[model samples]
Target: MNLKNYPRPFYAINQFCQPQCTELAGRSFYFDMDGGYDYELKVLTGDTCEWNIAGEEPKKAVYECLKGDDTTYMFDFDIVGAEPRQNFFFCIDLEQSLVTLVRCYIGRNPKFPLLVASEYDFGAIRVEGQPLPKKRHCLTGEMMGTTVEWHWNITMFTQHNYYSPAYYRITWPQYSSAEGSISPNFEVLAASDEISQYVKIKDKMYLYCLTEEMMERELGDSSPFRSNNMIFLQNYDRMYHVGRTFGSIMMDGKVVPCRTMFGSFGNPVRLEYNWLTAENPFTV
Candidate 1:
C-alpha cells in the first residue's frame, strides 16, 4: 500500500499495522483480578470472542490479539450492545501465568468528555490444577525520561518519549533528508498531550499506555490519535512491543467501537535534549 499522506489523525492510527493475529483463537482463560472482578474469556477464530464477568451472561463481539516475544500476548474486545461501550484489553504472559487487564471505556458524556478513559488492574490466569504465580506485574519508572522509535507499519514511524512520570510524548516523523520520500516516518511528539501510564513486568519488559483525551481537547479532528487507548507492552531489551487498542473508529462509513492488536520492533532513540530531564517547556 502506498501509505503517503495517510490521514486519520494520530488518535485513530491503522495505516501500516500488522495483519490481524489469530494465535489466541480458540483459547479460553479465566482471570481473577485483584480488584475483585473475575472474568471468563473464550477467544474464537475470525474476530469474535465470548466473554462475561462473573455471574453475567456471555456476550460476543469482535476481538483482536497480537503475540509478542516470549509468550506474551495482547488482546482486546468490546462488550457488544453495552451502555457507554466497555472494551476489555488483556496483556497475558503464559510463562509467568500472570495477566493484566485494562478496561477502556467510551465515556462520551458531554459534561465529562470521557472519550476513552481506562482503569488498569493486575490478575492471575486460572488453570485447572495449577497454582497461580505468586508474583505479579508492578508499576515502575525504568523507562522514565527515555525515548524509543516505534515503527507501527511499513511507512508509519513515530517516537515515544517518556517525558514525565505521568506523561509521555510522541514525535511525528518529518521527511528524512537521507532516505527521501520513499522512506518511513520518525520523530518526537509534541509537548502537549503526554499523559501516560507505565507498568513493569520484569527486567526490561514494561507496559505503556496513553489516551487521546488531551489531543481531542486540543486538536479535535486533526490530532493523529483519536478517542482510543494506545496501550502496549514493550521489552526494551528485545526492542519489541505488542499492544491492544480499543475505541470508536470510522469503519466502513460510520464510527463504531473497535478493538485491534499490533506488534512492532524499535530501538532506543537518540535525542539532543531529553524531555524527561529538560526544563519544563510547556509550562506558561
Candidate 2:
C-alpha cells in the first residue's frame, strides 16, 4: 500500500511480545505534547496501574494522564463509529504536567496504534501551581529529526460532462460593431461514438477527461452548481457544467465541465456535451 495516501504514518511489526512490553500488555497509551507540560494516557484495557503525575480528569471516554515520565505505550480509542474527515485531539494529565495530542482519522475504520516517545529533557516539573505546557508533535513521534516542509500541485483529472440548461442564458461576441448580439440555440441531436477528440476551443488543448468524483471533490461540499447543471449522457442523474473563459475559449481548447454539479450524495454522476455550430457565420 502507498503510505503517502494515508494521513498517519502506519507501520506493522510482528515482534516477540515482552514482559514489561507496554506494546503487548495493552496498557493505555500516553502522549506527551511538550517537555514541561502535563502528560495524558488512555487505558487500552481495564488494567489499573499507578504512576506519579499532575492534575487528572476523565473527559468523555478519554482519561488525562498528568505530567511525569516521557514514555509511549499502545492504546486503542474506540473510534469505529466516528464520522469521516473530522479533526480532534487528545489530552493526557500527569500530576506534574499535562500533554495533548492532535489527531484526525477519516472513514469508519478506527483501530489506531500510537507511537509516543521523546529524548529531550524539559525543566523541573511543577505541582497544581502552573498550567501544563502546550503539546508538540515532536513528543508524538510525528517528526523524523529533519526540517519539515510541504509543496502544492494541481493536476487535471479528466473532463466529465457539459450542459446548457434552459435557465442558463448563452451569448457570443460579434466580429464588428455593425453586427449586434448573437444568441445561438442548442439542442442535442445524437451522440457520436465515444471518440476521444483533441478539441481546441481557444489556445489550450486537453488530452484526457476526468472522472465525475474527482470533479465534485475539487468543488467542495457546498457548491451552487450542484443539482441544476447539465446531465451526463450515459447517466442522466449525473449533472455537469462547462468550465470556460474567454481566454480558454480563444486559445483553441474544449471546455469540459465538472460532473459534480449533480450534487453530493453516494456515487458521482457522468455527462457529455456536443457543440452545435452554424454554416454561414461561425456560431455554436
Clashes of 1: 11
Consecutive 10-residue window with the lowest summed lDDT within model 1: 178-187
Best by lDDT, which number? 1
Count of clashing pairs, candidate 2 = 44
Q: What TM-score, over all chains together, does every model reach? A: 0.79, 0.22
Evaluate candidate 1 by giving its C-alpha RMSD to the native, one decimal.
5.3
Best by TM-score: 1
User: What is the per-residue lDDT of model 2 for residues 111-228, given as tens digits with 9 covering 90 to 100?
Assistant: 3111111123222223345553543212221111111111101110222222211011121124321122111101111121121112111111111111112122333222222111
lDDT of 2 at 275: 25
Off by over 4 Å in 2: 1-12, 16-75, 83-98, 108-127, 134-284
